[model samples]
Target: MPRFFSNKRLIILLVGVIILVALIGFSLRDRERVTLPEQLIKDAAGVGQEVFSKPAGFVSGMIGQADLLLDSYAENKRLKARLADYAAIRSEVAALRTENEELRKVIGKQESLRAYNPIQATVIGRNPDQWEDRLILDKGANAGIAENMAVMTADGLIGKVTLVTPLTATVELLTSAGTDYRVSALVQSGSGEIHGLIEGYDAERGELLLKRIPSEFDIQPGQQVISSGLGGIFPKGLVIGEITEVTTDEFALTKMAYVKPAAEFPMLDHVMIADRIAPEIEPVELRPESGEAAE
Candidate 1:
């Protein structure tokens, strides 16, 4: 009997659940006015759904935004890397452009003095103990450079080669202290040429002294002076300088002029070595061996 009752209760419970489901479906049908309690339950469920959906949507949006921010940071880093490489390339291009311009100027200087063989050399060394006037060249005897060769810049003569080694050469500038070397020069007057001797430099005056002027009246302050090619050491027509001041000696015998040097000595750089031509050998006169001694 108890077992029968238990079966009957289970059947009743199943039936009750089916009836409750049916009632709920009928009440939820898209239709008319509902009871207050049913409306209250629906409202409560809607509120619960809204509260959960809002937080879920907010968390999804935050994750999406974080992904976008990471992409932007990566792009910025890539751009910065490219910019650094571009800056390095640009700096190298600018340096090469400047170097090309300097080389062009050196070529132009070389072409102007086309008559003489120009041995272009860089100034390798200078002695701080000596004045800034002295210079040492990178070319020497191995390069056919010898003593007494004239050293000139782009414009005019600057010095003469005094000492030479296998790999280097020393040049004594015209502005050196206690320098007694002289150069025979000519003053280019309008009518005729006047002779002068470049003797020494005047440090206080910052000009060179051209002493023993043949005619002081012929040489004005603006007259040009050039090498006369008298001693054959320096080339003819090489410009020395222009006269700035003229005066007579204390003994009243000769005139002196303060001439500005054409070449700037303090900042000597690329120089040209005027390679002098080989001296010509005199021809031997032919005569009989017995007749030459008797005559």
Candidate 2:
């Protein structure tokens, strides 16, 4: 130590060590507040730490938010692509149906009530008050829509056009409470066709009523029900529903069958309007001869 440092230098080093030890002992005392110099040094250090840490925290937060945004964008893009594919598929199916009808005509097949042109349409509006009773379509008179035209979904028949306007048409569903609304329906069984009238809906059971059926018809559950083409509105072979339960009428004279509808009435979206090419028979009106039958 003597060779490395002169006497004066050694003395200065000893003095510096003594001062550092004294400062440490002073800071160790349990005081209420720090000294002015110590407080100043601590404040500067805190400010420096906050300045550096705040920017780092902000940058990290921005990166995390950016990652979330990127993920959401990717998901939305994927969904839009899938929706486009679905729309294309619907268009292709409609085209194929049209082509099939043309091919049938080319083969000179017998014209049947089941043969009709389909007009594609979309459900636009529904009245909350009337809910299952009625709905409105986007197509109207300009689209060749007429009243009494059968409206159906991909699943099966839903209703018929009751009113038409220039740009919109209203449909009265099979579930309507009006007693005047009736559909000529028939059940297809192994033996033959059993005719009945779709008169009302059983709200409690969520099924349609096929009434005025002969008790001897031997109808049972699981038999398919379809339009009979006698109603003059709906074409034949339009799938209405399937039989679920069979019961006797009030007088036990005729049988009534509860039918589960093929089309989902509560969730209608897209539909087709059937335009009948072959003429249907109209109801005949009786005329009094020479006012002899005024009564």
Candidate 3:
């Protein structure tokens, strides 16, 4: 035991190194049974790898999706523009169809009024306050349109011209709730059987009521009623509507019947004006000096 050759501190340090080498060799030999310290190191390394791998995978997925979105942007814009064009085309087609229908109606109306001169008129204005009761037309006195002239649709009569201006005329519907006008009409049943005056309208039922008829006559239903042309205001043979029901009036002295209008009022866009049913006869001027007047 020499002091310099045999140092206790150096001996202890050498033994510690030998023991550390032996432990590492033993751990390698029995690698399946890893020691706690090595197991802890493996787990920490695995956790670090997983943390780094997850972030890398997430970033990669985000970049791929972003590229796809950027590529689709132009295509989406193109699709949107195509949709707008398709919508515009649909609107144009619808407008064309509507115009064709209106034209057809006008033509049919003119044909129906072949006996009388027909003036094609367009509905210009309809006030909501009197939408169903009245309609403003484009034709006026200049077009030979006069007050009390019958206004008709393609199917049948709708109203009568009540007001006329230089360029426009106003029509008062036969179905007007406040209508004071009356039409002389008769039932056309092969024989001139029933005749009555169209006096008022039933607002609830949207029908014209005929009054002042002989209650003794049996006026049956489904009979075709038309203008009698007796008063000379309304023309003859104009189809009004069929007799739906016949009953006694409130006074029980006269007969009353409901007549549905043939015209679809409040939805009309075009109509025909009966310019004149008969030719206007100029009055013959008489002079006082004439032979007939002096004689």
Which candidate comes out best when scored by lDDT?
Answer: 2
lDDT of 1 by residue, 5-100 (tens): 577889999999999999989865533344566545544544454456456656766886898897998888898989989999999999997886
- For all candidates in order, the CA lDDT equals 0.72, 0.80, 0.72
Per the 3 Å backbone cut-off, how many clashing residue pairs does candidate 3 have?
0
lDDT of 2 by residue, 1-295 (tens): 4398889999999999999999889875534344566545544544454456456656766887798887998889898989979998999999998987899899987667877999998665566688448876766777999877888998898888876665567788888876346788999999999999998899899999999999998998999999998887678999999999999998899999999999998767678999987686652222354355422
Better of 1 and 2 by TM-score: 2
What candidate 1 gets wrong by more than 4 Å, as runs, is 1-115, 278-295
Q: What count of clashes does model 1 give?
A: 0
Candidate maximizing TM-score: 2
RMSD of each: 43.8, 31.8, 40.7
How much is 120 displaced in model 1, in angstroms? 1.2
Model 3 quality (TM-score)? 0.54
TM per candidate: 0.54, 0.59, 0.54
lDDT of 3 by residue, 121-234 (tens): 877556568735887676666789887777888877777887665556778888887665677788766555688888888888888898888877777788888776564555
Off by over 4 Å in 3: 1-115, 279-295
Q: Candidate 2's error at 112, in angstroms?
A: 1.4
lDDT of 2 at 97: 84
Clashing pairs in 3: none
